[model samples]
Target: MALQNNEKFDIKIVYDKFEAALHEEDDIHLQFYLESFEELNKFFTLMGTVFGFVSKDLKAKMDILNEFLKDSNKSENFITVKKMIEYEKQNELLNKKGYTSGSRTLLRLHRGLDFIQLFLKKLGDLRDEESTSSACREAYDQTLAKHHPFVIRNGAKVAIYTLPTREILLKKVCGELDNIQKAMNLLPETLEVTAVVHTRIEKLYTVHDLHRLP
Candidate 1:
């Protein structure tokens, strides 16, 4: 069945919107675009359904951080990542075990996003089913494995083994086997855009980490 207009996934638009919002230097101190987190959750659900457990964990973190932003006072709003980091610094809330603060929670989500980006980019480059599966495993090892517990890592590996063949992925994303080349072309572009966004966010997190140090 053909995907409905609303159901169609456009990675470029999603990544671009996030890039614009995140790179708004003048707005770093202003309120974050709250709806962006909602959009991001949708993206995760769309891309990570095969790895349901991972998606669930990511959704939980995103929800917690978004709720924190929604509930913040005017002066202490956790809108931008920078503002979130600033609030955490002023309140001394970083690194508190068993406590959920916006900065730390967002950092977790950011790590998850990095994994998703890596997996998608790798999947985008596949030439066959075996390659697709290999890419997923490699991406998982390179990114998420370090963060996930042993059980979750093993579970993810099991899920990777169940991934649909490259032909199926092409048809799912590009809408037809005849359009496989189009899908292949699209993935690299998507990966490039996603990498740019990921790099920017990682840099922001790095800066936040440096500031947290003495």
Candidate 2:
């Protein structure tokens, strides 16, 4: 999609949808968001374009889950994150290798989301142009890097070096200089809300897993 006003990144829309999807703890409400995965994928692709190497694995994981959800026989049992986890467990769908279950796939994406949230938070908090790469690097190292292979981590560091300058990031996210401070201030709160949602979903998964254990 073409950038609006030649400056359209607008991560806020993605953040809004993510928040809404998280709030949908009810199966029916979660289904509504799942049905809109196409729109979400578009945003994901846009983010991948901006960040380059950071998003391909996430996109792949999303595709896997989306395909699984499209299966009529299996989709019904996966209306919510909790339900999806249960379905995977009950069906013995998760594997130790190759073709990991949708629940695990989504867990990977959740981890990536945490990294993205941190990166955006850092980007928003920046006060100078020179610090952009360092901010992204710091966020990546603190979050995603812990789980990533050494090669992947090194590649991500290289990608961070190529990130757009602070002015560009601010303009893309906030539209104009006047809006920057307001947008920046919102990032921390947004991260907090998303973290809560992620933790809740994770707890649900853990509880379900425990119930299934011998």
Candidate 3:
């Protein structure tokens, strides 16, 4: 995954995209949510090939959401997370066994977002000598790992070891700055905004009882 607009990786960009994703207090705009993930894909790409699975999964999920925006029948329903849930539930599309309903697809991305949020928070708290791999692994264990089976858990254990050192990881994500400290300072706001987006989506899922969609 190449950086969009040939741009450098910056935590501030991720922060802004996430903050832009929220609207009307509780509504989340799908386009901005995916755009934020596009910026996040760069973070995974910068880490190395070991994290390619993470990036590829996000790219695929983003493509699915983009398709919803393009489809004439579904586009209107997908403008906001709330609308997508209401529309999909009303139409009996949320649990059709194999159907790729917008609600179910976004739920996958929502889970991924949880992993990203936790990973970044851990990364931000690490000292210069701390292991980036440990942060990645811990974040995965707390979030995505619960949904993944044995094969993926084992694969992730190997893949996380390929992450660069804490200092280097900071350099890659905050590369736009001469001093990585500036970027580190942005993490709190970024995490807060992302938490709000995640919570909003989570509430929509709980309200509609769609958390168990498979």
Candidate 4:
């Protein structure tokens, strides 16, 4: 990567914040730390965003993965890395819509964005326009327990996810095992996953890679 101009920039500030998030000494302290890192008072500003709208930390994480795959450069490696970025972006978009991570709850429920909002507004404004809303349309159903991550969460990440990459493909057959393990952490100590998961084995499978996870 190419370095920017000699104008001015401090790398330590971000480094400190990243380190702090990993080892949250105190809840209050962590709040202050994250804010401190973001506030202009604590760090410099730039014309462009430090991170993109989706998954601000992706580029940095990509760098790490790149180093790990430096010698390999296999297509699978790139596919895995690309899918990870896409997942992060999708999650970032979800966050923008006010969905909190790590939790399996919806605050705003089903909110139609500006496009739909504008259309409805225009319909109401028209002299002879009629509009109907199927807000009751359920985006989820019984499959939610397995497919929709909201019904079940795994530490701020989707218990299951879909992507067209080798990594996600692997995650599918493994039942997103890592996240499954984490989700298990949320279960009652006495409850067993095998008892319920097996009954819900009809997970949709169109493609092999992200089929089960999706």
Which candidate achieves the best TM-score against the true structure? 3
Q: Please list the C-alpha lDDT of all candidates, in the order they appear.
A: 0.61, 0.62, 0.83, 0.26
TM-score of each: 0.75, 0.74, 0.92, 0.18
Q: Rank candidates by lDDT, best first.
A: 3, 2, 1, 4
What order do you get sorting by TM-score, best first? 3, 1, 2, 4
Clash pairs, model 3 backbone: none
Which clashing pairs does model 1 show? 32-79
Native-vs-model 3 lDDT?
0.83
Better of 1 and 4 by lDDT: 1
**Over 4 Å off, model 2:** 1-7, 23-50, 96-100, 128-130, 172-182, 185-189, 208-214
Position 42, candidate 2: lDDT: 42
Candidate 3 ranges beyond 4 A from true positions: 4-7, 176-179
lDDT of 3 at 30: 86
After superposing all C-alphas onto the true structure, candidate 3 shows an RMSD in angstroms of 2.0
Q: Which candidate is the best by lDDT?
A: 3
Q: Write the per-residue lDDT of candidate 2 for residues 10-94, one digit (tens) a residue.
A: 4355556556666445322244343333333343344446455555666677677777678898777766787777777777776
Q: Give candidate 1 misplaced runs (Cα > 4 Å).
A: 1-6, 25-49, 72-76, 95-99, 128-131, 173-186, 210-214
